[model samples]
Target: MLEQKHMALLEEAERRAIAPTDNIRACFELLALTGAIDRDCAVRLARHRLSEGKFVLLFLLHDKPDGLSPHELAERAGVTRATITGLLDGLERDGFIARRGGLEDRRKIAVALTEVGRQMARELFSEHTQWVASLFEGFTADERKTLHELLQRIWRNLDAGKQQTGQTADARA
Candidate 1:
């Protein structure tokens, strides 16, 4: 139950200005925690010369030996096709991925990992897995489940708010 460094400042600022209720304060805490996790992970990934997005692409490609199309990768990675292309270019240049025409659909090209890429994926994934686990090492299984459910509820609430506001899926981008 360790609090973030900014929690005290946040409490002070809220008390002096726009004071949030307990529920709203909890929401802010969750947002801050998620942001911290994302920021720290990005920094760590930079040490491996990888961005979070590139790591995701490599990991996804590792599980799909048959390879995926750029369109498929874009969808799976939740990014635009243009972004996937850039990722593929960097990976290809680094000898981590190769693109080839489909045997069945000659017009379509698929991206797959090289042997070097596979090894890189395994090593990176293993270490990153431990790093993430370490962040929640003290949480019991039940507490973890409760936290997951709570987060999902918050996500649904936010998504529903977007829908109510006439926001299209594209608007999220």
Candidate 2:
């Protein structure tokens, strides 16, 4: 099985004096699993002619009917304004979105989904939901809840590490 292969690799690593502690093995496995998941998700999105950024922008605009400014979209999407501009350009070229003057302020531009875009989002949304649900098909409801809690704990640990690093840097400064 896959688990046996992983165990054999870990054993080889340990035999080679590669310092394969339990924590190190756990971290390696987690990173490998997440990297594979990310790659698979990207492949799925590409089937619809969407990069992750484009897909995110599409859904964000889909949720916000009125529209959002380039700056706002960049912040919401966790990308740079320049990156957002490139995505918007591609979406507009494909006729999936439109950039128009804001209703409240004519000078300000807001991006909105066109009818075509809305229709695509609706279809993609359903497919995406099923795809995500499939990822958890092996887990029971309680197992899913436990997994969520454990992931949250890991996130908190990462956040705490970041804060500690910042404090150390500030102290050195």
Candidate 3:
């Protein structure tokens, strides 16, 4: 837990040394400097292995082990169902996924990663994770924890702001 004095010091540092707008700009700058945008583009390029169809499915599957339906993918990725459908179609065409009739009934189609897809997802996820980890090699564990907690709280405040602006759903939507 943070003491009030520590919180005040952190707040004072942000107020005096880092304007909110400037901090946001710096974040973008750091992303660019560290080539996170480039990394994302590389991942996007790997999609061309099968029109990024398999890659997106693999990433989503790995992100949610229980698995995600095409509709869930669209919501999580902030994409349209048609887009997810297209991606799934291409992935299925490439043998990275398979569709099964719903267990209890035969009406719904559920998708799952094929073994090949799982292997590919694991490899890509590991590669990207290593790259991200290398970026913070200088931070100690305690610093990392502190940063994580502060960022989480800040994120909540930002979410609250979005709610206030009607950008986020009401009732924690």
Please list the C-alpha lDDT of all candidates, in the order they appear. 0.85, 0.85, 0.68
The deviation in Å at residue 150 for candidate 2 is 2.7
* Deviating ranges (above 4 Å) for candidate 1: 1-19, 159-173
- For lDDT, candidate 1 versus 3, the one ahead is 1
Q: Which 10 consecutive residues of model 3 have the lowest summed lDDT?
A: 1-10
lDDT of 2 at 53: 93
lDDT of 1 by residue, 1-173 (tens): 22665567566767877655566567767777788899899998888778888899999999888799999999989999999999999889988899999868989999999998899899999999999999989999999999899876676568675676776678756
- As a whole number from 0 to 100, the lDDT of residue 153 in candidate 2 is 64
Better of 1 and 3 by TM-score: 1
RMSD, model 1, all Cα superposed? 5.6
RMSD, one per candidate, in order: 5.6, 4.6, 9.8
Q: So what's the TM-score on candidate 1?
A: 0.74
Q: In model 2, what lDDT does residue 72 have?
A: 97
lDDT of 2 by residue, 1-173 (tens): 13556778777878887774676578667877887778888999888778889988889999888899999999999999899999999899988899999999999999999998898888888988898899899899999999899876675457475575554544545
Weakest ten-residue segment in model 2 by summed lDDT: 164-173
As for candidate 1, its clashing pairs are none
TM-score of each: 0.74, 0.78, 0.55
Q: Order the candidate numbers by TM-score, best to worst.
A: 2, 1, 3
Highest TM-score against the true fold, candidate: 2
